[model samples]
Target: MEFFSKLLFLHEVASSHGKGLDELLIYVHLLMASLFVGWLAFFVIAVFKHRRSVNPKADYVGARSHFSTYAEIGVAAIEGLLLLGFAVPLWAKSVDKFPEEKDATVIQIMGQQFAWNAHYAGPDGKWGKQDVKFASSTNPFGLDSGDAGAKDDITCLREKFLIPVGKEVICKISSMDVIHCFKLPRMRVTQDAIPGMSIPVHFKPTKVGDYTITCAQLCGNLHSTMRGEFKVVEQAEFDKWFAEKAKAGGGGGFE
Candidate 1:
């Protein structure tokens, strides 16, 4: 039952990701499925037709056919073409470009056991200053107190990420503990949050809705609880939400 639900969940996500690379991925799946069905059918037919009751004689002679050789070569050629023509190009294109800087929003994502900590760079559009030595339960980022630029930066800890739809959003991710995977299916983005290192990733959501954000990494026993949602709203609504969150003593406490 769990596997069945998981499949349905994946189907829903796959439907959303279809707006991106999932389309091609589905094509590849169809090709592989067709090939597998053909192979399985041939295997069953061969077993039945070549059985002792059917043929009564095992012949090693005349087993080698020109068609078999041609089939093998053709399968190899098709696989090679798919790898070179589809697989390589898609991977290359996905990782090749970053969002243009103009009018883009940057959000910092810090992964911890069973939760996510988010930080907005304030209006300064900079990380300000960070001090790893001073980090604790209170100062999760270990932000240097002396840094004037980091003074007004906003921070939060929660199970959700909120952003404006149709705007480019860049997420810089890092983990405080073990490695964790940050996944947003609708945006077609997933990146690993390695401890002590930041990974830059970006995406633009065309749809205005709420999408699930799940941690794909099997972090620990509590990994299942590391689920979240990203809300894509209009610009005015997002601004109002952020303003209200900040006014209510930061989003961390508000949540």
Candidate 2:
């Protein structure tokens, strides 16, 4: 599986569930490859067998053997197994299953024209009050100044964010403007960010390192610049950073 994954040019797996996704990809591709070769062979055989010189007359009655029907059924069964036995189970186990908030890192990420905004509830485990009226270029989270919960919340604008390694991170993704796709290739995570909607997705980071975030959608003129950064670090390092960001009052803005 590793050899096939590398051959398919998949990035290094950073999330706990990434290898499963990679394996599914490899299997799907291998099935497609097999179908391609087999169909090509049949095409060549048909052309040669039905050549004009070999059979000048056209046969109106096309009678085929039951072998073809059985083959088709066999292919369909294999595909069903791939979907039911592997794909569906993986989706259920990795995607549908949600880790408890108390045991996970929950954050909100908003996508704008050419950047990302990340919001954290801080160490208090309480999210700040947010109103669309208070939302602006600098205050993407729309945090109410009068709300005590807002005081300790952390917001990082177009900057790198940190998550503890070996912990599940639940990201609530949203789009401030047009539709965008939040993609983390190494973690095998991708979720569509649509306006007026917040979608939640979770992935457990397994490797401690820096990872790149990309917008898979063609957003706008500067879509290519819609990039973000993520760092998976030790629990202590993440805690220290989180504490400092909270102490900074979670104030975020463009310079």
Candidate 3:
């Protein structure tokens, strides 16, 4: 599967569910390859059997056979099985069957015209009070200054956020202005950030390393440059960083 993934130009899979997704991709590709070969072979056979030299007159009723009908049915059946058996189940796991909140790292991500913003709940695990009224260029999250929860909330604007490796990370994605897609390639996670709607996607980063966060949509002129980052570090390292950020009043890491 690794070789096949590389052949298909897929990035390294870091999320737990990534393997399943890769497998599904390979299956779909194999199906397509089979169809391509079958059609090509049929075309060659048809041309050879109906050549002008072999048959001067065109047959009004072309070769009539149940083979084509059966082949079409078989192809549709395979496609249906792939969707119902594999794709739907994987999508359900990502969007519906979430890990417990206490055991997972929950972060709120807001997409703007050309940048990704992340907001963490700090040590309390309680989100800060936010309102559209308080939102501004400096404070993209609209974090209420007077709210106690807001005081310790950590915000990273166009900056890297940190999460411990081997833990489920749930990101609630929303758009500050235009529609955007939050995509983590290595993690095999992609979720749309739509205005007035917070969509959630989860992934467990198994490897400890720096991974990129990119806007997968053509949000604006700078959409290609809309990039953020995150680090999957050891638990102890994440704890230290979290505490330091909290002590510093959740430093504004606007880049």
Residues 5-27, candidate 1: write the lDDT tens digits.
35345434322223446645655
lDDT of 2 by residue, 7-85 (tens): 9999999999998899889889998999899889988998999999989999898646687788789889989999999
User: Candidate 3 regions off by >4 Å?
Assistant: 251-255
Sort by TM-score, top down from the best = 2, 3, 1
The deviation in Å at residue 248 for candidate 2 is 2.0
Runs of candidate 2 with Cα error greater than 4 angstroms are none
* Local distance difference test, each candidate: 0.72, 0.90, 0.88
Candidate with the greatest TM-score versus the true structure: 2
Query: Which consecutive 10 residues in model 2 have the weakest lDDT in total?
Result: 246-255
| Cα deviation of 135, candidate 3, in Å | 0.6
> Which prediction has more favorable lDDT, 1 or 3?
3
Model 3: weakest 10-residue lDDT segment is: 246-255
TM-score of every candidate: 0.84, 0.96, 0.95
